[model samples]
Target: MSRIVYVNGRYLPYAQAGVHVEDRGFQFADGVYEVCEVRGGALVDEGPHLARLGRSLAELAIPEPMSMAALAHVMRETVRRNRVRDGLL
Candidate 1:
């Protein structure tokens, strides 16, 4: 299966993933990210990770790209698509 990456609001093939050079996240490093450890199809240390994401975004004065629920859903979907049961995402 081809790898899918979430960029902007769409999931695209890895080979096609692209971000505009002017995007703030790329140009000014104005973004926050969280990595949830996947274990047995579940996320580990999720709460703390989300908390940190929120804090980082707040500190950077950038609103979250999506809601926590949406972010969680996307994270799980990405992991599932990649067939990653034990990994950091």
Candidate 2:
């Protein structure tokens, strides 16, 4: 199956997901990320991971890409789209 990815505010197939070459994250690594594990379709330590991500962004003076709630929704949606029940997310 083709993997799905979230790019900007849309979900697209991995093959079609592309970030601009000049995007700040790509050009200067101006962002923070989190990799949370998914077990039985539930995120592990989601709260802590998000908190850490917020702190990292703050430390780097980078704006959040979206609200915490929205980011959380996206994370869950991405995992669902990929049908990942137990794996790193």
TM-score of each: 0.87, 0.93
Per-residue CA lDDT of candidate 2, range 1-89, in tens? 89999998999999999998989989987677679999999899999998999999999999888988899999999999999989997
- Lowest summed lDDT across 10 adjacent residues in model 1 is found at 28-37
Give the count of colliding residue pairs in each prediction. Answer: 0, 0
Error in Å for residue 70 of model 2: 0.3
Lowest lDDT 10-residue stretch of candidate 2: 25-34
Give the local distance difference test score of model 1. 0.85
TM-score for predicted model 2 compared with the true structure? 0.93
lDDT of 1 by residue, 1-89 (tens): 89888888888899999989999888987676667899997889877888898889899899888997798888888888888878889
RMSDs, each prediction?
1.4, 1.0
- Give candidate 2's error at residue 84 in angstroms: 0.3
Query: What does candidate 1 score in Cα RMSD to the true structure?
Result: 1.4
Q: Judging by TM-score against the true structure, name the best candidate.
A: 2
Can you tell me which runs of candidate 1 are displaced by over 4 Å? none
